[model samples]
Target: MILNSSLLVSIEKHFCGNELLNGEMYMEGIKHYLIDMDGVILQGTKLIPGAAEFIQRLRTKGASFLILTNNSRYILRDLQVRLHDLGLEVPQEAIFTSALATAQFLHTQRPGGKAYVLGEAGLTTALHDIGYILTDQKPEYVVLGETTTYSFERITRAIRFVMAGARFITTNPDVTGPGEGGIVPATGAVAALISAATGAKPYFIGKPNPLMMRTALRTLDAHSEDSVIIGDRMDTDIVSGIESGLQTILVLTGVTTREQVERFPYRPTWIHKSVADIEVEG
Candidate 1:
């Protein structure tokens, strides 16, 4: 559905209001919400203030939403446990990760394909679940994903595979991500290293790519016009939302700050100080 100018204006006015909510403000047009996980919900293992409450509010109102993440380190169960440990209740079905998105994309591209994977349980499990064979033996694709410690030997093997004509695929384009000890090299950084070595670039299948957002919307049975994307990054989340034809909400609690946002050519539909400032109730 196309979001007309009047509807966009109404959304802007609703966010600008100081009140928590007016009657049916959220239920009026927005039925689905796509939320980012890392900086928007939690920074590393620490929960951002009001993150749990915001999710609870969605659950309480029976609203449709999904916690989307580009991190391909852990599987859905791991993420669900982590959120539970942080006092947030998110079902596995309500969470979507880049690992899952990549796997889905690959499954559609090449069914039962062989891959040489450099990732953790998340990436491996997703591919395995989709009937992909994880091997270094003339793999159809050399899949790069996030890992705590990237192995030089494995990267060497990946380069060799790419040189041998295997396709290259990476989970996301995030060079660094927040970890327990500040920032760490993510999938994109590792993919860059491999690309530099092999002179072959991997197809990134995560945020900033509208494919990821489109798949998430399909999973949620949501339409862009009635859905909202809440994220902390302008490059990935906001751009992807815009490309996917969804209203975007930029939160200052993540990688992109207000000043950084100003540098971007386009703007989000709304900007909030944090998730705490957003009222999902109506």
Candidate 2:
């Protein structure tokens, strides 16, 4: 049965136990998904309700997907371990990190190049796998990524390298990340400090930078018209998906709220409580 716009809001419907939700939501004809990991899937270290179910729904419908994250601290294996510890099972190839995108970007620009890095296993491993050498001796680029331990000594070296004409690059533009107590300094925060000292701005290669989105789509072998992105933050995930020509779904389970969406000029195609509320038609 067809319903008018007024009736869609006044009456609720359900199919196969999934509620037909509101808020510009539409999942029909979506053959692929690009989902944000931190907010849309798991908040902190715990799995968000319905996250696994959503993945299962995608798999059941023979859809392709990739879990996207801006955090560059851990490699794919590390992320797999963390997700497994949280009672969630995700394939290693199904996860994509900003570090990987950064490495890919550098590989294309200057293959087999040297770089001075300030990150954990994730960033360094990605750079290494891309045939890029990690060095501090007159490197071509000074790469920055998220690290649990922020060292003044390493940051100082990065600043000096940038001052010496080494191009600056960062994994993501997030200034802060979720910590036990509150928000903590991230790659963007340190990038800001380095910029202040050297007067050189670094290129960001994560969400909100359609570059990463396009790279991910290529990895999935999927087209934007047939893909959908589910994220919580409007500035990064939503904006990047919109700019990349993919459908965007904003979940309220993370930073952005229902009322806060009105503040942005651009709007997500859909807004829901969480991934669980989303209906993926089979």
RMSD of each: 4.5, 7.1
| Each model's backbone clash number | 0, 0
Whole-model alpha-carbon lDDT for candidate 1: 0.87
* lDDT agreement of model 2 with the native: 0.88
- lDDT (10s digit) by residue, model 2, range 1-282: 985764343222212112334454667788888999988999887999889888888888788889999999999999989988887788999999999999999999999999999998999999999999999899999999999888999999999999999999999999989988998998889999999999999999998998999999999999887888889999999888877777788899899998998898777777889999887767
lDDT string, candidate 1, 1-282, tens digits: 898885666455434431444322243677789999988998767899999888888888778999999989899999999999988888999999999999999999999999999999999999999999999788999998889989889889999999999999999999987767577888888888988988998899999998999999999998887888999989899888877778778898978988897798766777788888778744
Tell me the lDDT of model 1 at 104.
Answer: 96
By summed lDDT, the worst window of 10 consecutive residues in model 1 runs over 16-25
TM, every model:
0.89, 0.91
Supply candidate 1's per-residue lDDT for 9. 60
Highest-scoring model, TM-score: 2
lDDT score, candidate 2, position 17:
12
lDDT of 2 at 225: 74
